[model samples]
Target: MTRTQAPRSSPSRTSPSHLLPTEEPLALLRPDGTPVEGSPLVMPADDVLVELYRRMVVGRRFDTQATALTRQGRLAVYPSSRGQEACEIAPVLALRPDDWLFPTYRDSVALVSRGIDPAQTLTLLQGGWHLGYDPYEHRVGPQCTPLATNTLHAVGFAHAARLKGEDTAALVLLGDGATSEGDTHEALNFAGVWQAPVVFLVQNNGYAISVPLDKQTAAPTLAHKGIGYGVPSVLVDGNDAAAVYAVVRDALRTGGPTLIEALTYRIEAHTNADDATRYRTSDEVAAWLARDPVDRLSAYLTARGLLDERTKDDVAREAETFAAAVRAALNVDVEPDPADLFEHVYATMPAHLRAQAEFLREESA
Candidate 1:
């Protein structure tokens, strides 16, 4: 999860007892679009911010397109990232080119930001011959659908990198719900013990499928759990990309494991197959909408004169073009050969598997 810096609360007008209570979370921009003191936060260069914005726009568009494509039967079910693009993009862009990313099944946005082709995402969803490239070769591990299992793999990768004297780090993205899994706890322990160079990013979207966070844990903040394991942790406003970037950057740069619990809300259903309306309220959605990440960033940029109507229009058009291209690419059906599944299972198939493969072929005929 990324660090979002909210406006600083000051001690009263000039008196010792006039101080206001500090908001638990930090945010450089408030919900109303006011620019709080932007300094002291790890301020990214303008180019980096623009690049981050581009990635967010592209990711949002890709998610929208994929959702539509699934409805049209062009692919298997898609888990929409609707309203959570910044939650995906900021930390991803904060990484060095050589850094690795371990993403969850729903984190296509992070993969896209990492330079994975849009077609590859569709291919994975479609279950085509190529669910895409070898992730290790791409420096982004395979998408982990088994909840928190990938966090262990990330720790292992970071451990290996340390052994090899590699300077690169790993960032593992998992949902807030994943924190409840035993694998997540074990991974945190290993990462702490080994002092692994990885960042456990928990995108706290307030729900674990239909289960709300309250039912998932009694901890006041997920970040606090890291303390028990001896790993430093911080909770941030997940929607503020700038804050997210700064916090994540500091964590990654300092070495060892850091847990960033990004506070956010998932506005849509867990996936195309789930109905959020069944378990949540429209009022809750409306309330989160008021703190939408994109709107907040846009408002900040506009106030600073960095984003104008023309620039906004251009960004929207560019995103639409990318979405159209993804739609067009998914239309091409690439069938996987039936024998291909067995081809890559082992370096050399044991006699039993060899015989089984033949048996399968004959049985199919």
Candidate 2:
């Protein structure tokens, strides 16, 4: 009694708790707008921070504007990246000039951050032209719409770069739902075996169309899937640009294939044609809104006295000017040629395709 009977250890210490597995990659700013210790951010450096903020704002504005255009029947179906701007922007910024990017359908915001002309994106969306740029010139591959197929392309690119002794890396974007596909698994396996310099970025936006995450897999986390493939994996806050950038940079420096599972939410419908309310609840939407990336960054900047009312107004005005310019450019009515498809099939058209092209020409005439 006098020795205060040795504190009994809880037997629960040996028991594992069934909690969702997560990897909290380093975050520069805390939720309350405070800087974390040893963060890579230099907030006082106004130029870089302001430029990064501008890119994020412009990307978001462009996405919102495009959604409106789709609804107004100006463009065909458009993927809305409403709550995903920061996730797209961060990795694009972290890339070197010669590095390659494999963008998915919803990664237009990524192209914007990587210096792609907004008009070109619009042209593709409006069906006025093919991608409208030489992929080699931009080092950005054509957008892949066949879900997880681009993962293999990224792996191949990395393997080629390694063979050529090139100091470059490949970054491939995919949706969380894409992980269920065989291609995604194969890509990871090959990359890991070869130690390819590539990064597999999975934007976990909680839903693949109408199917929720729980139904897709019994695995604790998408990032953990990489473990079996022998690729190092990490999870990060996709909504936070700083966090995303940090993780991408780390992956790039590590010199091997890495899988990043970015935990984010799809605030808008999957695309303009989708009706999220049919499956998800309003309460879920409201909760995500509370964690809005732009709002979070704005609050942080304001709290630090870096952003004020006048600065916000200036940002708004700049965004509006950009949107107006994009709108005017997109309004130009230019229909692409149907025959152009046959033109690019080969350097010298195959005999059968050539005959087919002539047949089409004669039929049209």
Candidate 3:
């Protein structure tokens, strides 16, 4: 049977009635690590949950390390996805090998979870040239800095793939703030009209920089925005890795446009340069800290006897090793040749650029 049709074990645990999504966000696990009522249609195995937990640990480490690197004058800047690791890693795990992921600037964790080397994934953030790694090699689009621009690119790619009759889908991720951009609306509209095999996952981290959701839009919910475009929508607890994975996997099986709005929080500032404390309160941060995605999964696994002290130690050791490797890779300074900047702009260098390149060459000589 296809993965979407795979049978799942029956719900073995009962949870509070309020835990499940009605018109609310779907939450599969409570904050205390208990399973919610109405279990997912296609539950993943214990091993899969273990792996997801491992990735979440690594993703958290990556964010912390990157933020430290920025503070230490190593990286140019960083947009840390500290509190949203579940949203960062789960959807990538749900996709097929041939599927494409279009990530936002803050989605370094997602790209890393998708098999890109941590160093390569952060290259753009390091102020390096040319998106760090080849997009075609990894089937990941550029780590886009411009808001909502990559949404259109993802839709176009999916439409082209459908035209070519390829069994492929594209997943586009954007911040809640980007939902307000015109490009986002246009992309969703096109995807719905064409029935493109693309999914849009909005990580609603409660703010657009310092602007809270209340200030960003008057829409009842971001998912509602998709309904107007003729696309189905889901509201998932962004902190529940299992639920996010299940929803994304099911959406992929539909072979059409869908939108998933994950209600999450951005634990860190918008980036290393921004001071979140100036706008948000410490109590607010403390409240979300209680609902941390990594801690939630670890608690659930431990309660189920799936995670023990040894396993926790192993995951922590692995995360430390990964962080060390990323630090070492990023510490090596790269001295780019100034003249090489003029080489890749076009197949044949234009006369104006040729003159500029000559000027740089003579100056350096």
Candidate 4:
């Protein structure tokens, strides 16, 4: 049998296979829109696939719209997750509404897939509010700009939920560069020690803001890093939406901490401010573009008779409307409130901060 062929029967299977990720990234669908024979993983239902495709289409449109917003000065800066739609949308669909999501600045598309308002998702990058949405309301923490810090937060929440006898899980999204952070080590250690119901989704999009993975770490794959902490890790083809959903669903079902490294590529620059052409070649980008998650799934579904040209057009129209709505929502003229920064810092304003607030108010006046 293949290394990943065994079904996950128990969470406490004391076997090496359970402790280590597959040697190769797991994939359910190939680029040519066909399933891999003997993959052991169950394919999602046609209805689920259709929903996933819709969300992916909309999420990607929202991503590109945010990019355009940056160009139009509607946002201060924007990070694009163009080629990583499967990694973004699938994981969100894998979570229960009660489960928490700890995301980074690059996971705005995931937030959109989670039913978050597009305007609210960009609040931090808008250079306005601390966070446009309340964490408790959405069961999602504020998006961390720093690397791997949010992983620790996920562990803490998961571990505490376990102690309280709550059947809860936390899913945290990290970039390939975040694997090098000290908190990544700490988070994995704590999760393994406590057996916290947390899943780490590391989107390994090749480069970490110009530093290639080769330059970052010597590990075979970022998923392998979990083995050191006694956490089970798996690598998945990030462009295969079906594979992402199946793998993540299996991990969550085991009811413990797991790490997943998704093999994808960042098609756009690090952010709107950076130039991607300097660090990467067009040929590489074109190769990944041809393997786009959205297109691959659309093709597979259409071939299977689960989707039609009409449905595809309808989904695209919906995505366009969603993008247009976000555009309208953000196309507003508003002045920043100088006092707002000081308001959330303290329950009762500290004397020093009070003075600072007053000074800023007077200066503005």
lDDT values for all models:
0.82, 0.81, 0.89, 0.90
Per-candidate total of colliding backbone pairs: 10, 0, 0, 0
TM-score of 4: 0.93
Off by over 4 Å in 1: 1-23, 38-40, 129-131, 352-365
For residues 215-268, write the lDDT of model 3, one tens digit per residue.
989978888787677788888899999888889988887899888899999998
Instruction: Tell me the spans in candidate 2 whose CA falls farther than 4 Å from its real position.
Output: 1-26, 36-47, 350-365
Better of 1 and 4 by lDDT: 4
Candidate 3 TM-score, true structure as reference: 0.92
Per-residue lDDT tens digits of candidate 2, residues 175-243? 988999999999999998898999999999999988999999998788888777778787777877777
Q: Clashing residue pairs, candidate 1?
A: 1-201, 2-244, 3-243, 3-244, 5-26, 5-27, 5-28, 6-26, 6-27, 6-28
Q: Which pairs in model 4 have colliding backbones? A: none
Q: What is the C-alpha RMSD of each candidate to the true structure, in Å?
A: 9.2, 9.4, 9.0, 6.6
Which predicted model would earn the best TM-score? Answer: 4
User: Pairing residues by index, what is the TM-score of model 1?
Assistant: 0.89
CA lDDT for candidate 2: 0.81
lDDT of 2 at 355: 89
